[model samples]
Target: MIKGDSLMFRGRLRGTALWGGSLLLAGCMLNIFLQAASLGMKFGAVADWVARYPALYLAGSLFLFFLLLLFAALVPGGYPGPLLAVAVVVLLGTADNRKLATTGEPLFPWDLMLLKNAGEMRHITRGMLSPLWIAIAAALIVLLLYGMRKLPKVRMRLTWRLLLGGVSAALAGGFLFVVGSGSSLASSLHYENLYWNQKVNYTQNGFLFAFAGNLHQNVMEKPDGYSREAILRIAAKYGGNGSEAANPAPTGGTQAEQDAKMPDILFMMDEAFFDPTRLPGYSFSADPLVFIHGAAKSSPSGYLLSPEFGGNTANVEFEALTGLSMYFLNDGSVPFQQRLVKMSSLPSIVSILKQRGYAALALHPFDDTFYNRNRVYPMLGFDRFTSEKDLPKAARMTPGGYISDLAAVQEAVRELRASKGPAFLHLVTMQNHFPFTSGKNGPNTIAVSGGKEAYRKELETYAQDTKLTDEALAELAKELKELPRRTVAVFWGDHLPALSAGIYAEAGWDAKPRLKHETKLMLLANFDIGAEGTGTLSPAFLGPEVFRRAGLAEPPFYQLLDRVKAELPGLSGSVRIGSGGNEIRKLTPEQEALLSDYRLVEYDLLEGKQYSAKLMF
Candidate 1:
């Protein structure tokens, strides 16, 4: 019934639609295949192994397609399946690649929080675009756009369309619900089973499955042996009756006399700042930590055994603030993101100081949202929190793209000056954070005496950056000297700088993770507040020690800390520093008993019921 010209036109349109649609579908499949192959390759999987692992590609495609379908239904789009599928592949692949390169671990659900905070993203290294992937993605996008125009649109009745869309959404929702509840299945799986070492689980089960498995593990349980009676028995041994009594007046003075002598106490956690001269075979042209050395002579100063190395500043802060050791918690789990969420009351240094009329302020020269600190601070009992957003101006950054330590000190001093009465300020600086490469540092100001040329540049950069922080310390001390109110400052490095593998080998430190974990600590006060004999102390003990030196009423756990410090001067999840030196040695019977008690108390506060906390605090 149609004319020759009209029939031919219709035939051409049909052919174009078929070819474009084919191209789009093929592109989506190819994108998923490539991404799965890339993830496999990261774990040293060969081509043969990847060819055998068909389920990975299939599961990824199905989940991705369902997500796209749900997104399309929510909007007015009519099946953006291919485009969205390709997008999911590219984005996830890119993020996983970058995370693996930086942290040597695959991306997990917690990392999503980091991506939401733009300021925290600065800490991560941005990956460059792969030309092959980019070219393929571009081709897919073009094909998708072309197909969208020519493809025949199937018209459905309005009611049918709505019903079909709802069905699609319900299917997606149901699948997600299954995933959330499938933890028991994962527990039974062979290599994919959740364990203490999360890296192993990720390697065995693949990133997607392992991430879901971790979500189930987030719910902490009581220790293997936990009872209120046992907790009380331990508390009684330490002279703690577990009563919330008002702080008794000082033995030698009245409450008014104590008030007159109370000083503004500040705890400053300097990031990646350490005494690099501790290296076995390295020497510098001049002393890098000249100021710290001078301070050590007069003030209470020594090494501190940090719970982590290079990163995990939050954990070190956790132990210092709350007297809980990461050693007892799941390995590499973030307390702020994981455990702290469930806690309503944390017996932290901030809270202890607050009980004695000190306004507690939390200060950090970075995003308030990183590690969910803005939320966590309230639970820790901070009166106010000042982050980069609250600073007078945007933070002044170093060449390494971190906020300068000098600027952070200035901000802390400003806040202290503004506070009305005795204050407890916790400040975390960012100047000396990791990746000590030439690009990050301005210039090699310090000269290295011995090292391969490859390591010399990086070492010099770290040393130079450390010197800058030391200079900032000197500046801070000068500023504190001028403050009208008596002030006590606790300055300590969070952990050592993350150096290159070659440098560690050259310095004879390759086999020693414990020695590498040591960082310096110094407690200095403008007025004479007597604190004696500091060889090394764990971060947990540091808080009570600071309170004692500042003439504040001790927390209920002070007795426990004193006993532990007498035998084990420093201890963490990994390393211990005793009178001899840093070592990964077994705990003595005496030490074990103390550790058992410490663990029980911490368990009660963080994980178990709060019956013990009420008595203790």
Candidate 2:
């Protein structure tokens, strides 16, 4: 009997060892598969990565394997746990791939927030997942479910299962904490967190590791010596006792007369608008931006240094409205989804104009739920918000199924005409949104040459769409000219269109970081504010410049921005265009002082206490 019991125990131990070894191997394979998928399913690239940085790759695989182990331990039958884990990783990897293709940036943690509006974002995500792909995914899921059902279940004692799960969960949790918290262990292990350029980070480090690093992104760290006293001192220097010294009223009018003369401001942030004529070694059949070129000749127009590339329109809009620099925040964060929804009110151009008796209104020819704009607009101090649902069917018509820019402009005009007081209308058009396919706009009118044959369709489609936007702009300028009230319009593109990475590479735009972020900016008005010549400026500085050009009293924060604008005209996360269009690699002492003050004030307003809130805004 004793000999029989000993043999039985040995058999059980062998079975457990085999099961554990198989689970470990499966987890490692899944991790490698996910890593390769992140790099566009290039297994040779994964091999090259392993050959180059074996230790880092090993560590990443171990982290992922431990997570899989924890998931396995959670279930009574281990087969379903690995299946669930695979599904989760596959979904994330597919999303990251699509986002990278569209936006040139990998998926960040904040992007998960957009999943809440998945139904509303069909316009952008429509062609990403085709029927074939969906069918394949469904088949795979069904196969996995069948396999899970057929697999034999391992029966373990309740106490042993609890211990196994607790141990695995602890190990997974500890690893993430050590790595994410930037502890000495993470540093000693040579874990690099390259959050700034996530594309390279994901390719070099494993995607799972790179993505996990962003889980604890502190969007804006508090500036050094950030205190109420420091904020007060900065405010005292630039606030100027709430006087409009930085932006004095126009010479011809009293204070009240200046207030009355303030022009109704309209900001039209066009979608994916750019001058294709600027592309080197390429010729268009006709000038797609003819009207805009003529308008820019006399208006305050230049390349607006956008903070985004192909997507994330809200970031550019945030900078233009709030005078806040994305340079100060994390690279991959969306302030609208991540920060603004948490705040009750934010000091912005909308709030400033509202304080000056201008009725603030926001109009976007898209779903309000996108980027949580419906919730964010009110916090930004807009008195009214208009979205696609608010418009009539005629106003919402577009060849690409997005609302047309002409219709959006007409809506803006209607709102301005109906308003009793001076209005500040911000209209974000959706006509030129992405997925520039052939015949989407009913036969492209624009012809393109001198580029790869593969990109010709996208190029022609984008140019044709841009031409429509230019026509809309011409119509808007004509309407504004006929208005009885003086009106000023700030028209600009949020970013360059994602017309295939090959086009930008062929044009040599990818060689320069600034070229990828630069977009057309024009300031037009019925009355001349004596603004002329093309110049480069950051979107953050555009708000204060608009206030100054409008001859309106700027709040203290904008006055401070005006000073910073003189020193650092164009600023973004990657590059800074200093005074006279020269890029500044290093700042002078005076520029440093100015930048420090600006950082302090920004920190105070955004992350620190509300010390300068009442004084600045």
Candidate 3:
């Protein structure tokens, strides 16, 4: 019974069982949490059937989860913990996507409660909803307890061989931790804590968190997506004559005194419209925006350096609200969304306008909650937000609650006319989004409606509606032309429209160049915000330029914008100047330092989830 060989074998078995059980517990817990969380998201709601057969589901899921952990732990030098975490995240995310596709259930992060389709969530992010979790936890506990019982007995017979084994395990653990921390593998370990992770995806960060595409919406998560030059320019915070600083008008006059004299502000941005110079238009059914831009103020738009090109309007919105690009920081976090508590945005121009006796209101036909817009608009200092739910039932026909751009205009006009002060209206149009075809799902009520279907049909109707928007803008101008004070209106694309990747590829193109991610910006109005009726199209200068042109108080940051333009005179005319040296390249040290501050501030706010309503973009 006490043979040396047998006793030695028993001691080794006890040690292996102890750690193995520990690994199993961690694996299952992480696996369940990730899967349940995935399922709990709008994207995974369709996979509720996995829970229908609890016993079978528990058995199958754990077998796979435990097997991987076992392999990882047994491997001589493997990245077990971090890799396991990512695998679970991806596996569960994929599961939800597949189940949703198969079940014909719509799945997306924000679709949880807003969705009216059939069925309900069967699992929650917490383990309680998953019987499999319960099973796995119980099994691991039993194994751990069983291993513990033999632990004391084994120690009673401890020998040199046993001591050596224990030391080896400790060394291995330390080594594993060091290796894991040095590589990108560990970056994703605590990814959930990121401020912007809710919508900014890291789901496809290519085996590690090194890929920033999920955050920058950079194609394939390349480093080129973030321009180091920009981050080093502004000290990571809004500075100089920009709107965030309470600089007396870049020219002069308190906002309050400028009230009766300053014009009302109207703004719009197109989606996914990258610069033609950065991404030329070789073939097109129509150059609709270019045609529309003919009469608008034209300038070389500043380097937007956006995180997303084809989509992610929220990023663009953040840039405009705060007058700083999100390109410089960890694209993994979103300061505008959950982390916005106390974050500072350009002092709400709307709030300042309101103080000057101007009415400030925002209009968007989509669910206001998509970007956590409901939580943010108030923080942005807007008095009211017109979302799709606020629209009549007839207006909710389109996907994404895209009523009609004109409807938003109508609502904006109504609110403006009724408000007690001069009005500042921010209108975000939706009908002309991606898949620019036509359809039943698009807005039936249109000034100019297209009759097609799917995401494309919405786009067709959207372009048609643009003419209406133009006409409406003209009409609004006619109405405000005689207002007591001057009226200033600004319209620009948030980003360019998304064409079929195949079609974009087929149009005598690389079929896979980086341009697919860049978009053009349009800044249009009947009034002259540019002093010479001359300036280029750039996101960086829009706020200050528009403010200065309108003869309103410009912030210090805005003044720097003008200085930037002066240094890079040719920035407005083309993506490339006579030489490679451009404005972005010639940033002054002060500017570079400012970018550092901006990044630092962003990093701090995001790292510490301290949100404050005072920071409005």
Candidate 4:
């Protein structure tokens, strides 16, 4: 009644289904085990706390297992029969594909010798899947062997269509191995896979999934007395919020004369202001940042040790505001991007001034909102932020079309003076951002001197922008020099503009000091702060030095930062692999203890738990 070959046909199909189903289930378990092992071995193993994620992890594991089971169980020959011949060959090939995608990395199953204890543990887990899979294949093989014993008798009896279906399913399983692994496995691989995420992502303290509550909490959580008192003692002792809170009221400072009371503060970022190849004592003639260098009460300025190379404006900005260097934490992620911004930074400075009865405003003629600065500034404690939308736009010095840095300065100065009381106005410039292609085709840059002729047109336009900024500062300084309130104006480049790799290559400089030229900071000051000098800094130094010059009390983390500085001696120490002529990436217990001591000190200073510096050591 069911169809042709009734009883014999049904028995054949049932046997095939059972055999195929068992093999399919084994394949799914094999997938999870393989992924986890590869993650551990390749990108430095992840912590073990992750194993506890039952909802997401366990469910995912089961789903994969069952999907494979369903595919096999529905086979024409259900259990230990001809159907198994299709399943065994499929699992073997899928395993090989797993080997291919995880190549180049340490995992690949074959590189088990290189794995550490953690990788070894995971490798074992993956290996467990091996025997189980092998066992499934053996069972299927047995089923196929049994079916073959009767195959000569049955093949003559079964239809051609059923044979075709079995072959097709087996081939599909092999295909999944080849095409469905590695970076190509899924689109979600970029931000999702814990392994690749660590290798390539520049996000949250490495891979977020690596953490499994406290289970994966590797190393010791509190190894010694120093680490036990992380936030309060260490922070206040160093220069943290405890000290931040302990500092005298922001309003207690001695009042300057009317002419000196509310002087303007100007900060400038010279775009592409670097020269690695100096044509040997060429004097490189002309005022690249000369107007600022010569006219300003120059102290001793030098290149800053910075965190970013090609482009990382936020790194510079973070240093400028919080005084906490981004280098203290591991270098993969932005603390602010995470819920990790915890230092006494720009916001605190502005808030202090505001609490002290001052007007605080920040102005950057570019999109002030470009880097979520609107939110960041508010968090940093500014009363107002003026970006390009709020200010009139002017042609930039570079192809990026940023407003002239000078324009931002003039606009800020004019606006702040209209307000009452002491004020903190921060200004960031444009024009010197990038794409150093401005005026390249225009006649305007023809007269510029110094630098390269290849960059002649671009330099001409940039010089004009630089001069404009200088002219504005000169006028402002001249006016403030006699103002009623004693004002402090500070100007420095955010970052030097960088031409493309080709430009440097064409200039025949293979070993130029690219990092040195690109990271220089130009400091020009008027009023009391200007006397601090034009010395170079690692931005880590900028905070302490700036506050010290401003006569403001150091933030809570000051003590710890100072101690850290003594070890590293510059801002770059915190972020770079090298510091104070030493190479140390991960913190030693001794260093962490020392830093934790500072954290505890700052905790005592700020009188709060969250006041801990975001990530230190």
* Candidate 2 global lDDT: 0.81
| Worst ten in a row by lDDT for model 1 | 184-193
| Local accuracy of candidate 1 as per-residue lDDT tens digits, 1-617 | 46988998788677656644553465445434444433644434533433554554345345555555544444443545445655665666666655554344456666666777764565643223347657866886787787667655534356755775687677655544445566443234332445466655555455555555566565344665689898888777776676664353344576556655668888999988888888876778888889988877778888778877766688889989988777777655778877786678887777766766778999998788878888899999998988877765644544437777888888888888998777889999877766676756466678887778867777888888888888888988898889878898888888877666567778776577666777888887778866564777778888777767877666567778777777777776566765555553877898888878888888888877765565555
Compared with the true structure, all predictions reach lDDT values of: 0.70, 0.81, 0.45, 0.46
Best by TM-score: 2
Worst 10 residues of 2 by lDDT: 240-249
Per-residue error for 149 in candidate 3, Å, reads 36
Q: Please say which candidate is ahead in lDDT: 3 or 4.
A: 4
Candidate whose lDDT is highest: 2
What tens-digit string does per-residue lDDT give for candidate 2 at 1-617? 99999999998788777767767776677667767767877899989987877776777667666666666778777667767877887788778877887787888888888888877666687666657668968987997889789976666777877787788788777877876898887776667888766788788777767788888776677778889888778888875454423233345656557556778999999988888788887888989999988877678889888899989999999999988889888668788987888888888888777766788999998888888899999999998999988885734334547888988988899998888768899999888887787766567888988877767778888888888889889999899888878889988899998777888999898879888888888888888776675488888887887777877777788888988898889888778988889888998999889888888877777777767777677
Candidates sorted on lDDT, descending:
2, 1, 4, 3
lDDT of 4 by residue, 398-452 (tens): 4434566556656766766676666777776655554444553132422554445
**Per-residue lDDT of 563 in model 4:** 57
Candidate number with the higher TM-score (2 or 3)? 2
